[model samples]
Target: MSIFISKEAKDKAQGYWFGLLIPLLAGWGVSTFSMAALMSRDGPVSEMTYVDYFFITGWISGGLVVHPLCAWWVLLRAKIVGNAPCIKGAYMSIKLYILWIFFLLSMTIISFIWGE
Candidate 1:
């Protein structure tokens, strides 16, 4: 179980990691430049562009709920929910990602203009 499980797990991780890399990168880039980022003080996080995504979005929502829940949803769809549901869910997940980037932007702008 050890080696097999390890390899399979790595494969699965790589699959998801690469699968979402573009969306992640796009989201990060847009979020960094779009509006007043939620947690941005006066500069980019860590002076690294990608780190901005990893910190604000990752910590605020991704770490708290999005990443784990999406992983579980993906796994549940794959293992238990069957193909159709998985595909449908995956499509919606991508759409949700698009809308979410917009939502974050709107929220940041509103907060900046309106306060609190």
Candidate 2:
């Protein structure tokens, strides 16, 4: 009985971890690293404030939300129109990546204008 219960709990936990937690954490990590790298490109980040950190993080989080939805939409449209899934997904992903780069640039500009 204990073994059965343990297995059941593990199965449920796997679903939650894979379906939600993994993606959210991956998004957070990617956003954090990307923002930090981009910010450091202009100069050293020895004196950044909490507000600056949050601003960069928030912007990347917004991008993380937008990027996947937009990609899914593209993939859906491709499926409806009878295009190849692999090709469409790849193309859309690349486009979204470019947009992410653009987003980073815009964020950098905003940060500079807003000041340290």
Candidate 3:
């Protein structure tokens, strides 16, 4: 094994990390925080107004849509810069996206069960 890493390898690694981190943070992190904040409000879930419901739906659904797009964009940019291919980044993004979905679903269920 070579001790030194090539620039291309480094770029690809960076691209992969960015693809994972950006969406995970921007999409999952923000949505999770927002949802938690909304849920943690003074009133019960049943007391949430239309606007609150709209925002909750928007945040979760929007993250589902937008974050993957963000990942794709990042991967595309990396490819354009001759760093990495889209495959690995895309795979990572999809995995994270799935996990995010499950998390949101579980959170929603838990909130509904005990959020009185």
Candidate 4:
């Protein structure tokens, strides 16, 4: 019935969770919100399939958000290239995930409420 984890364990878990979840969600969320925006503004798109949306969002999210953070984490946190506090990096990633999720949910709600 123990539920508490050590600080380092929590950080590692957070880091792994960030690696597992955020990239996929960020890509999908960005794509979905962007598609919603495009449809709302342009009114019924004939071009662009789901695959296109996926690829574009994957590229944007991975390139902009995930990859850079991964690089930094691998390099600095894991000591692959630099020296830095590992837990801090993990905490930062968690914060980023929270902000991104909040923004994504907010945009999705707005789209649902106001989109046509």
Candidate 5:
């Protein structure tokens, strides 16, 4: 409502440990699974046994950081992905939702126009 990142998003960004715990755990789970699969594919690495997992953890953290930023971006662009301040919500909304569709559309258009 106000520029970008409403009170809700701010709440999420500044959310309690429990709020962040979900994102962190979501990050951990996705990272762990992806790491296992990728490491299995790449065979073994003497350099590091769980490097892929580290990568996943990095990615998950990135997602957590990006989620709130994306929320802010939505506000500036008026691209609403309803209740998509979290990973799970964004995943679900991306499949079937006007807010997400609009946001995706805006990004595509912007990419085509700005080459970003």
Candidate 6:
């Protein structure tokens, strides 16, 4: 097989990788740092402890709690707009929100099983 890769394929791969990587890292960083801070007294905890628990809780909270709240806010905004023309952005947001809900639900189930 040829080793050459097209620029479009390379870009698509990078986009997929970064899209997945950035969210995971963002969730991990937010969860880990926040947990560490709360768990600490003198100062922010420097080392990660109970990493798996933090990651699981972070993803769970982000997907279930945060995502729904954001979706609500979007819906509220749409309501305020009151019969305005359909915005392209809204369709994209709705798709992303649905995907996130499914992903979060799966993650929740996995975490529950794993926890047991």
User: What lDDT would each prediction earn against the true structure?
Assistant: 0.54, 0.57, 0.73, 0.57, 0.48, 0.53
Best by TM-score: 3
Residues 23-81 of candidate 4 have per-residue lDDT tens digits of 44554566566556555553245676786566567555653566446534443544553
Q: Considering lDDT, which of the candidate structures 4 and 6 is the better prediction for this target?
A: 4
Candidate 5's displacement at residue 69, Å, is 1.3
Lowest lDDT sum, 10 consecutive residues, model 5, at 75-84
Query: Which candidate, 1 or 2, would have the higher lDDT against the true structure?
Result: 2
Q: Where is model 2 more than 4 Å wrong at Cα?
A: 1-4, 43-63, 66-116
Q: Largest lDDT belongs to which candidate?
A: 3
lDDT of each residue in 1-116, candidate 1, tens digit only: 45546865666555555434433444445445533554555764466566555555544554235543554456465556344434444555566676776898899999999988
Backbone collision tally, model 5: 0
Clashing pairs in 5: none
Put down candidate 2 lDDT per residue, 23-87, tens digits, no spaces.
33445566676676566655457967776677676656645674465455555555675546333
Residue 105 alpha-carbon offset, candidate 1, angstroms? 0.7
Question: Candidate 3's residue-wise lDDT over 41-81, tens digit each?
Answer: 78877778887876688577558876887777777776676
Model 3 lDDT, full chain set: 0.73
Query: Which regions of candidate 4 deviate over 4 angstroms?
Result: 42-116
TM-score of each: 0.32, 0.36, 0.60, 0.37, 0.26, 0.36
lDDT of model 2, residue 95:
66
Better of 4 and 5 by TM-score: 4
Q: Candidate 1 vs candidate 5: which has greater TM-score?
A: 1
Give the Cα error of residue 110 in candidate 1, in Å. 1.7
True-vs-predicted CA distance for residue 88, candidate 5, Å = 17
Candidate 5 structure quality by residue, lDDT tens digits, 1-116? 46536776665543333233443355456556665666566554655557565665655644444444443343333324333334343333233234544786899999999987
Candidate 1 accuracy as TM-score? 0.32
Q: Least accurate stretch of 10 residues (summed lDDT) in model 2?
A: 15-24
TM-score of 4: 0.37
